[model samples]
Target: MSQKPAWLTTDGAPWGRGRARLVYDNPWIRVTEHDAVAPTGAAAVYGLVEFKNLALAILPVFDDGTIMLVGQARFPAQDYSWELPEGGGPLGVDPLESARRELREETGLEAAQWLPILEAQLSNSVTDERAIGYLATGLTEVEADPDETELLALARVPFREALDAAMAGHMKDMLTVAMLLRGYHMAREGSLPGALARAMLS
Candidate 1:
């Protein structure tokens, strides 16, 4: 008789997966379909999408409490999107480097200070897409090198007005919306510099 591995513990068991098959794959994502045995002893099948990169977002705030937003037409949905500077970094690469590159590429702004603001899973049920957001300050202008596929328009808006627009549904990109709200929270909670926060709220 064969013995189960000691490292495989069922102490707080939920579900067990059976055989898995690769359903689809691409450079960016892969889909796997597998059989699963639920904790209730019910059988189920799961289709999982795995992302090959980490999503990185940067919210660049100028000293005057204005944010740099990028407007472009997003595909599939075929709608115009106003979003924070965002891009993908290889999974194992340092995300900050990706953030710096993306911010520069999109807005031609570089920051001396970068604060980690948010870490989250974008779609837990469907895809293993992870995201990280940063608040960037001490900005200086540089030359922008936008992606070939992007036709970007830059907008500098007051923090409060941008947040209000997002809250009113004018901005629907989840990362942008979340970061704007978080910036507001930081201002109210005194997590940011008093003058800067006041400027943002004002």
Candidate 2:
């Protein structure tokens, strides 16, 4: 069995929190400001954004080795982005079910197999946004049901091409990048089925 790294296995100094106050609130997020002392012993003010939902991303891989991607304009970045189908899942909901919903809602695809591939804390320094990524395969097409606020475009590309584009910075969503890299790692490390890995790496 694998073990945690020595640094993680050992306890270290932790940040100390002082007074905290809510600075902003919305249906989806809550922002707070806190007086804090760093592990380095320096006093600091910390602003944190807490997401009310768990972020979910799905990499929909088809039997033919292509994957589905969604393109939309991101409000904060004010730029168009091409990413794996992603959305927010209620904190209490099963992430796989949410992933399936996001896949169908955003890209009109449903999968026969789902593999949880990655879990990450997004923008950890400033936000408490957590993300879960899934690898979806054995896909079938259906009608897309995107949210009213979204104006999305869909594309189907080879897995390698998508990974290469993400690596080349054409796809900037960190969750999407991480998922693609994780998928690549799985393919190379024999974590995936032999045929599926061959299809992905081909």
Candidate 3:
């Protein structure tokens, strides 16, 4: 038996009334289990997952301050639209490559330049997804080969309007909001933290 960390042992029950799967026998949380519960009482089996690592989301912005975004039918929210070029999960391709692929697949736009704008680990108090935001300029368009189920549209909203949409609950994607707003000032001024700090003070 591999040793479990001290933090994992605290305030722990059978993770409380959830599904159990003995995914890993060596180390404690190398386990991958999916539990179910009712959000509104006696509903369906919900998921209590312990995945490998956090995922990433990118705010792929281009020249002229336009953001590359995609809108699709979200089955979970029952809402059909609005999201960025994402899909940097725990597996498969690395984050930067995933960013470029998602951009090409969704928008048919490719970048000759790449800038690492913002990086973050997700709110573990809620979920475990890590995201990195990017500034991709010097773009050239290619033929768009969208997925059969993917119905996508591209919009170049001013950064302020993007923030307003998040505020008004229109652009309600969390990673989108988190990256854009927190990293907004940096994007406009074209510097990482230094120019952003100057913008904030002014």
lDDT of each: 0.92, 0.92, 0.63
Instruction: Count clashing residue pairs per candidate.
Output: 0, 0, 4
Would you give me the overall lDDT of model 3? 0.63
Tens digits of per-residue lDDT for model 1, 117-148: 88888978778899999999999999999999
Task: State which candidate has the highest TM-score.
Answer: 2
Cα displacement (angstroms), candidate 3, residue 192, comes to 5.2
Per-model RMSD to reference: 7.2, 1.2, 8.8
Instruction: Give a tens-digit lDDT track for model 3, residues 150-193.
Output: 78877766556666777788877787777767556664555654
lDDT of 2 by residue, 66-109 (tens): 89899999999999999999999999998888888889999998
| Clash pairs (backbone) in predicted model 1 | none
TM-scores of the models, in the given order?
A: 0.91, 0.96, 0.64
Scored against the true structure, residue 33 in model 1 reaches a CA lDDT of: 90
- For model 3, state the Cα shift of residue 35 in Å: 13
Provide the global lDDT of candidate 1 against the true structure: 0.92
Instruction: Tell me the spans in candidate 3 whose CA falls farther than 4 Å from its real position.
Output: 1-47, 51-54, 89-92, 188-202
* Clashing pairs in model 3, backbone N/Cα/C closer than 3 A: 35-46, 36-45, 36-46, 37-46
Which structure is stronger by TM-score: 1 or 3? Answer: 1
Question: Candidate 3, residue 146: CA error in Å?
Answer: 2.1
Error of 1 at 37 (Å): 2.5
Which prediction has more favorable TM-score, 2 or 3?
Answer: 2
